[model samples]
Target: MTRTLVVIGHGMTGHRLVDTVRDLDPAGHWRVVVLAEERDPAYDRVRLSAYLEGHSRTELSLVEPDFLTDPRVDLYTARPAVHVDRKTRTVRTADGDEIGYDALVLATGSRPFVPPVPGRELRNCFVQRTLDDVDALRAAVRGGQPAVVIGGGLLGIEAAHGLRLLGMQPHIVEFAPHLMPTQLDADAARVLQRGATALGLRLHCGTAVTSVDAGPDDAVRSVTLANGTVLDTDLVVFAAGIRPRDDLAVTPDLERGERGGFLVDAYCRTADEHIWAVGECAAVLGRCHGLIAPGYRMAESVARQLTDHPAEPFDGTDTSTTLKLLGVHVATFGTMPVRDSQAVEVTFAEGTTRYAKVFLQTSTGTLLGGILAGKTGSRTELTPHVGRRPPADLEQLLLPD
Candidate 1:
């Protein structure tokens, strides 16, 4: 007898879970059922900004043509799981459909966090999350119009770049003193700032948006900063941060992390033995990692367990990031030391274009973490040697060959 596996949410991580399970149990030991909230199937959200560059929805899709046609897999799109009946081991969808499961997994993912500011719900305001969001933004925007993007994080920068691509003049407003504060130090952020300015992006760092003002037509017109500076614009985009989509887990009385997300163990198992969670919704070991890499690992771990295969516990995640922002290359890896006393800091800079910094243990030569801006040719070589000591030629690791 084959057991039924019900997966809630069909985002990138959820799709990976289903694919992995099918690979492990080709004999159909566990039949898979996926409940997707979106009308369209899973797409490459990591490259979501590419949609702004004229990439069609089909181009962004992560699903293979024949993958969903598998006999053992049942996919229900635009069906969001509304309730989890823990006692009955069942899930209730918003469309009034109920499905029973021998094992259940929640991959509800996350939502963009919009700040509580007046006029935020105005017509031209948007958040970058799904294909529909980018579509809406594309339709609303007019070339050469001004746009204000709140938050200077990765998502915010990406949204700003997309706005630039749409021929809109984007002004980035960040509460932090520098750009990419989570990933880069003040000096590195300066280098990044230079690149963004060169791309015609206006940045307002160390300020918060006090309110989003609207025009007489109730459409977003301008934003007032905490520092009394007001930026007139036709669009307002919120990319501040993300919060887990764990509302459905509330009725089940599932434990949640302190920051948010359904609390789960290293195995991605919740309090209920039969139910598991992966992706942004699952707070494995009291921490919720927003990156796709950790989410994919969690999905694979859950898939292996359901297949009765040996799997390693998810102890932690690699928070390393490497990407291009506004035509500038940036990379950050390993643990960044906060104080100078903790680790030895080595930095190299070249004419406001290239900057590289590495932190090494004070007692040992072990690499703690590093930041690369402009030129990131060494990122691939240096990332792997993060916890370990690098070769004797340390200069070779810092510069491009």
Candidate 2:
């Protein structure tokens, strides 16, 4: 008899799980059901900023033309799994439909974290997350309008670029002293700052938004900073961070991580043996893996478990990133939050364009981590050497040829 597998939250990771299971269980051992809250199917959220560059919804889709039409797969669009009845092995949808399943997987991703500043709910204030978000931003933004983006992380920079592409004067406000504070060191951030400024992005580093002031119509007029300076803008985009969508994991039996993700074991299984979780919603070892690679890995691992295939335990993954923002390349990999004394730091920079830094164990020449800006070829080459002693000279590795 074929077992039924119900997957909630049909985002990128959820799609990966379905594809993996379908490929491994070719004998039709498990029938699949997917619940997607979004009207559109799974799309490449990594390239969400491309919407500003003339890319349509169809261009960014991760779903294949035939994947949804599979006989064994039942997809419900715009229907979210509102509640899970684990005792009866049933999932209740937002439309009051109850679907039964033998096994359930939660891949409910994350949502943009909007700060609780005053006037944040005003019109023209937005957060970068889904296609609807970008579309709404485009509708609100006009040519030559001033725009302010809060938080100078990856998403913040991407929002700035996207606004600039739409002909808006984009300004970035970051509480941290440097841009991409979590990924780039000060030296690399300086170079990236120069690149971003060259693209007409005005940045206000080391500043926090105290409040967003609105006009008489209750629309975003300006943003007040912690330093008593108010920036005039027509639109405000918040790209501070993300919080996991762990509402579905609130059942008494299911456990949750401290940071608001579904608590899962080594195999991405929740406390209940029949339930598993993957992606931002699931927390493994008490922390959520928000990146794509780790989430994909979890999806694959869970699929193997369901198919009775030999699978390795889902340990942690390398939190590496490589992307271009405003035409500037930025890459960071491995352990980046180490203390100065923990590893020997080697850096290379050329003017305000290129910057590179590598952390290594000086005694054994073992690579620990690295950050690269303006160039990223080294990231791909050096990633494999992480935790392993490299054959080449450390200084030569840091320098770009």
User: Which residue pairs overlap in candidate 2's backbone?
Assistant: none
Q: Write the per-residue lDDT of candidate 1 for residues 1-401, one digit (tens) a residue.
A: 99999999999999999999999998999889999999999998988788976799999998997777899999999999899888888888998888999999999999999999988999899999999998888898889999999999999999899889989999999999999887888888988999899999999999999999989999988999999999999899999989999888435589889998999999999999999999998999889988887899999999999999999998564677788887788987777777756689988887778888898988888998788888645577887887888667766667666
Question: What is the Cα-based TM-score of model 1?
Answer: 0.96
The per-model lDDT (C-alpha) reads 0.89, 0.87
Candidate 1 residues lying further than 4 Å off, grouped into runs, are 337-342
Worst 10 residues of 1 by lDDT: 314-323
Highest lDDT: which candidate?
A: 1
Candidate 2's C-alpha runs over 4 A off are none
- Taking the candidates one at a time, how many backbone clashes does each contain? 0, 0
Please give, for residues 130-204, the per-residue lDDT of candidate 2 as tens digits: 999888888887999899999899889888898888899999999999998877788889878988888899999
C-alpha lDDT of candidate 2 relative to the true structure: 0.87
